[model samples]
Target: MKKNIPIFRTGDTIEVQVWVSEGSKRRIQLFEGIVISKRNRNFNFSFCVRKISNGDAIERVFHINSYNIGNVVIKKRGDVRKSKLYYLRNRIGKSAKIKELLTKK
Candidate 1:
């Protein structure tokens, strides 16, 4: 993982800014979603984010040390017991939601 990236875990809602380049144009694209899983392997550390868009579920995997990742902002901390929230894939609406964890400070 990179030094600038903050500590995050599965079930957390996070917004990631990714740099997109199209020919001579370049822009930052935001992908906001819940982290379903994470893989830690030294330099190959990565996490998967899942979101619902246009009634379709979309999942994206991002490498922590990738240069294309501009930034990651944790929107909400989830109170989940499991490390991998793969069960959320089959859920919808309220069923797919995760409970928020209250933090002091």
Candidate 2:
């Protein structure tokens, strides 16, 4: 049996380094974005990340325990409503942004 570890949550901005394989080449790709939602728990866990690219909003879902994921670095925290930020899709520009929370280290 595999033991699950709690590592991330919604509203956290994280930089994820993922390993990608293309034929005989392997490389690490970096993705930085805010976690908008988390679903299930333990081995079935998954989360969605939202980022703006080329003046367009982009969202991606990643598994918690996938081999492609190399590391996750939390960059900032956000104040939000509900567990999922699906409403953000309808928002644009400044209205779509999440408020940053200052944390005491």
Question: What lDDT score goes with residue 96 in model 1?
Answer: 97
Q: Summarize candidate 2's per-residue lDDT along 1-105 as a digit string, tens digits.
A: 224333667888889888999999999999998898999775568899999889887788988678788877888788776798888888888887888877688
Best candidate according to TM-score: 1
Count of steric clashes across candidates, in order: 0, 0
Q: Pick the candidate with the highest lDDT.
A: 1
lDDT of 2 at 50: 90
Q: In model 1, which runs have C-alpha deviations exceeding 4 angstroms? A: none
lDDT of each: 0.94, 0.82
> How does residue 102 of candidate 1 score in lDDT?
96
RMSD in Å for all candidates? 1.2, 2.4
- Candidate 2 error regions (>4 Å): 1-6
Candidate 2, pairs of clashing residues = none
